[model samples]
Structure formats: C-alpha cells, structure tokens
Target: MYNSQEIVSISNRNIPSLITLPAELVYSILDNLDMLTILISFCNVCKRLKNITNTYHRYKTFTILNLTHHRINEQEFECLVNTLQNNKTLIEIHLRCNKIDNQKTKSLTDVLKTNTILTTLVLSNNTISTDGAQYLANLLNNNKTLKELDLGWNQITSEGIRYIADALNNNHTLTILNLQINNLGNQGTQYLTNALENNRTLMTLILSNNCIDYEGAQYLANMLCKNKTLTTLILSDNRIGSQGVKYLANALYNNKTLTKLHLRLNRINSDGAKYLADALHNNNTLTELHLGWNDIGNQGVQYLSNALYNNHTLHILHLQYNKIDCIGAQYIADALQKNTTLRELYLACNKIKNQGAQYLLNILKNNQTLTTINIQSNKIDFHEIQYLIDILEKQRIQF
Candidate 1:
C-alpha cells in the first residue's frame, strides 16, 4: 500500500547484511570457529548461512562430540549426520565419548556407505554393542576410503569381535584398528588371529586390556610367524604369562615385518625375559620393545643386556617398574656401552640407587646415540639426579 518513494527510501536505509559480505571473507571467519559451534549456532541462522556452512571445503576434519561429560542428544546427532552427508570433503570424524548407541550408529554407517572421502572414524567410549559393531563391519566390507577405525572402550564382546574379524578378512583398505578395553577374551583373540593370518592391509592393532590369557597370546604368536603386513602390536595389561611370552619369543625369531611390540603388565617373569632375550639375539626387524610392569628381576635384566649387546635394529626399550635393582641397573649400563642403535631408554620407577646411577651416568657421558633416558622415581637422591642432568646437558641429551 506504500507509495513508490516511501518503499525506495525504506530499502535504501542503513541495514546490516551478512549476505552482502564476500564469500571469501565469510569463509575466512568460519575457519576460526569450531565445527560444533558452526553446526549448532551458525548453520541454521538462514538459508544463505546454511549454504555457506555446508560448503564441503569448510569441513575436512569435523570433530563435533563433547569429549567431556556433556551428552549430545538424539536430535543433535541427527543434525550432525545430515551435515556429514553433505560434506564431501570430510576426511576425519571424531565422535569419542558421545554415548552413541546402536540406533544412532545407523545414521553414521548410512553416510559411510557412500562416503568416499572419510579416511578416519573414531567412536571410542560409546555404548555400541554387538549389533552396532555388525553395522560397522558391514560398512567395512565395501568401504574403500576408511583406513582407521577406533572402537575402544565400547560394549563389543566376543561375538562383536568375531563380526569385526570376519569383515577384516575382506577389508583391503583398513590399516589401523583399535579395540582396547573390550571384552574380547581368548575366543575373540582366536578369531582376530585367524584374520591376521590372511589380512594384508592391517598394519597396527591395539588389543590392550582385553583379558587375553596365555591361550590367546599363543594364537597371536602363531599368526605373527606368518603375517607380513602387521607392523605394530600392543598387548598391554593382558594376562599373557611366561608360557605366552615364550610362544611370542619363538615367533619373533622368525617374524620379519613387526617393528613394535608391547607386552607390558603381562606377568612375564625372569624365565620369559630369558626367552625374549634369546629371540632378540636373532631378531632383525624389531625396533621397539615394551616390557614394563613385569617381574623381570636382576637375572632377567642380565639376559636382556646380553641380547642388546648383539642386536642392531632395536631403537627403543622400556623396562620401567620391573623390580630392577642396582645389580640390574649395572647390567643395563654396561649393555649401553656396546649397543649403539638404542636411542630411547625408559628405566623409571625402579630401585636404581646411587651406585647404579653412577654406572648409568658414566656410560651416558660417553654415549652419543641415546637421545632420551628416563631415570625418575628411583632411589637416586636429588644430588645424584642433578649430577646426571648436568652430564646429559653437557652431552646435549634429553632425560
């Protein structure tokens, strides 16, 4: 009903318009905001803003979950999934600690069915069960872009692990899988070991805190003897006893592809240590060995010292909290004089006294290859620690 002049005047008045801003400038501002903030606050402001936020280039790595205790409700999860469907540039998604259950996982797996750009998916600390894992396993069967999948601290039991293991047999693109703190006992370990025997693309496997016993360890050891693609294996906090260590040691003598092995808190005693030491005498590909929190005493340290004197590829050794007394420290110190390839040594939380510290300091003063050495939480006094620090500083080393 207004006249032409009045309508023109109203339109010409001063007004703020985000749509008038250059697209490049808007993108620059959005680049500084977190994905959650953009998704929750900015995307639904208007059609223009939604279009700008949904641009795939703005989200190559989207992390929208609350890592703390804050829970994302079902509606927000649906919105996230819808956004993911539009983002063709997203390469990584981290949904850790989001309380995602089987129903919510369907939305994610549905997007993954056609997602060709996503390479990493982290769903750790969720409420996913056997059915949810089956959905993910089905996705793995045909998905070619996914390389890493972290399902740690979920409710996946032996049945769920079997489903994942079966999928792994056919999956050719996945390289890293994390199943830590799951309820995968000996039976689940058997399934995964069978998959490792034939799978060629998997490179790193983390199965820590899974309650795997000696039988499970034996199964994995048998697979290691023939598997060629696996490079790292973490079996920490499992109950693999001395017999399991012996089995793994026998495999290490012939395995050529594995570079890192973690057997921390596995109840390995001096006998197991001797077995590993004997295997190290012939092992050529292993570069990192973690045997912390075991019962390897002075005799075991002496055995490892002899092995270090001959091994050439070992670069990192962790022997922390293993009841290593001053006598054990002396053996390790003497071994350092002959081992030139070892670059990192962790000996913290031991019983190394003043004399033991002196032995370590004397060898470290002359050594040139060792870049990091941890000697904290031992019986070495403050003055001795300061002296060791001074010597390392003089040699430009780290402790």
Candidate 2:
C-alpha cells in the first residue's frame, strides 16, 4: 500500500539494522573504498555509516600518487579535508606530483594541526618552496604522531632546511626523511648534518641530485662518523669526487649503522675507489654499494676487488656504464671468487665483449652466491649467454 519513493526510504532506513553488520565489518568495507569513492558513497549513506566511514582505519592510507600519475587537485583535496576533518582517523597521506602551491599547503597544514592520527606525510615533487616547507616544519615541531616525512624534489633551499634541522633536534618520532633533489645546498646540508649528531630517531636520508659538493659531503661524513641511527644515505650525482669521497670513506670506517651508500654518476674515480676500498676492508655493516656511471675503470675495480677479499657484508654491487672493459670485468670476476656475499651484480652496457663475458662465466661457475647478473646490452655472444643461463639454472636448483 506504500508508494515507491516511500518504500525506498523505509528500506534505506532499515538497511543498517536489517543487515546486523558489526562495526568492524563496516570499517573494513569502507577501508577498501578509494578516497573519492569513499567520500561519495559513504557520505550518501546514513549518519551511522558516515560516522563509521570517518574512523581512522577507513581512509588511513591516502596514496595520491600511484604509478599511473593520476594526481589529485586542490578542490578534491579540500573535499577530502572537509570529509575527514571531524573523523580524526586519517593516518598517512601521500601527495606526490599533485601541483600543490603554498596556499594549499597552508590550508593542508591548518587541517593537519587538528589531525592527531596522521603519522606519515609525503608531498614529493610538488614545488613546495622554502616558505611552504617551513609551514610543514612548524607543524613538525609540535606534531606528536608524525613519524615519517618526505618533501623531496621541492624548492626548499638551505634556509628552509635550517628550520627543518631545528625541528629535527627535538622531533623524536620522525625516523625517515627524504630531501633528495631539493635545493638544500652546503649551508643546508651542514645544518642537517650538525643536527643529526644530536638527533637519534632519523634512520634514513636521501639527498641525491642536491648541490652538495665536497664541503657538504665532508660535513655529512663527519656526522656519519658519530650518528648511530642512520642506516641508509644516498649522495648520488653530487660531484663529491676523490677529496669528498675520501672523507666519506673515512667516516664509513667508524660508522656502524650505515648499510647502504649510493654514489652513482659522480666523478669518483680510481683515487676515490681506493679510499672506499680501504674503508670496506674494515667496515662490516655496509651491505650494498652503488658506484655506477663513474669513470672507475680497471684500476678502481682492482682496488675494490682487493677489498672484496676482506669485505663480507657487501651483497650487491652496481658498476654499470662505467667504461669498464674486459680488463675491469676480469678484476671484478676475480673479486667475485673471493666474495661469498655478493649475490647480484650489474655490468650492463659497459661494452663488455666475449672476453669479459667469459670471465663473468668463470666467476658464476664457482660463485654459488651470485644469482642475478645483468649483462644486458653488452657485446656478449650466444655461447656466453648459454653458459650464464646454465649457471643461473644450476643455482636455482640448489636454492
């Protein structure tokens, strides 16, 4: 006897009670919904559904940047803010490459001030300049929940980094910070390095593609000698050559926590490699080292090979596109025979011909640890490929 619209309303009203769904189940369903869809569908539901959807577990991980590069806009972001403002359950928000400006950053920070649950925030590749970054740094000074932050590829310079460094001294929860590709130069690196001497929570840092030269690198090296929590440091493409790299190698001799160091595409040559080899001989923690795209030829490889005889922690070494020929490949292969830890090696696009390939084959035949070797685009022949594949198959069977 009821009208169609009336009946629809009654059914919608009774849907929650009729289902007898638990609160946890409702949360799980909302958690699987995308940000935009969560806003649309959950908001359209009854007040109870809206309340349940606003909980922390429902929309905790907001990944604005997926691999496809479909970034969010300001209005949509604001819609998100408005939807979650009173919810107090959001935890992580990733806003990579969304073209956000200072105004939006300010607005976002204002909302973040009330957001007690958000512990991880990533705003990489968004041109958030010094002022914009400072706004977030200010939030960090008081934010208790934020434990990880990434502001890489922003326009934040030395002055902005100083603000962040000041916050880092007192901020205990933050463990990982990425300032890579930012304009944080010598003065900025100096500030950060000095503060790191006092700070203990920060465990990993990426400063690649920044304008940090010998002075900046030396300052960081000094800090590395003292800092205990930091394990990974990336300084690739920084032009920190022999002089700077020697200081870093000296620091590595003393630093116990650092396990990975990336120095790719720098001007680090045979001289720098010698310094690093000396450090590797004594250092026990460093497990991965990337020195690719440098002019570290046969001489450099020889020094590194000698270190490999003593170094047990290094499991992966990348030496791709470094002008290494069969001579350099032979030196590396000799090292592989002694190195039981090295499992993966990259010698791609180095003009390595049959001679070099044969040397690598010999290493693979003896070295049980070497599993994945990239000899792609080299001057390798069919015989070399067959031999390498056979070795890999044999290893797979053993594993």
Q: What lDDT is obtained when candidate 1 is compared to the true structure?
A: 0.86
lDDT of 2 by residue, 1-399 (tens): 999999999998877761357778876776676666777346545767676655645354543323114466655777756665564545667778888777778877877766677777888888788788788877888777888798988889998888889889888888889999988888999999999998989988999989888898899999998899999999988878888999999999899999999999879889999999999999999999999989888888889989999899998888887778889888888888888998778888787687887788777767788877887777777564575557555443211
Q: On residues 127-219, what C-alpha lDDT tens digit does candidate 1 reach at each position? A: 998999999998998789999999999999999889899999999999999999999999999999999999999999999999998899999
What TM-score does candidate 2 get on C-alpha atoms? 0.85
Candidate 2 clashing pairs, residues 3+ apart or interchain:
56-89
List candidate 1 stretches off by more than 4 Å: 1-34, 40-50, 54-70, 384-389, 394-399
Return the TM-score for candidate 1, rounded to 2 decimals.
Answer: 0.88
> Following a full C-alpha superposition, what root-mean-square deviation does model 2 have from the true structure?
5.0
lDDT of each: 0.86, 0.81
Worst 10 residues of 2 by lDDT: 61-70
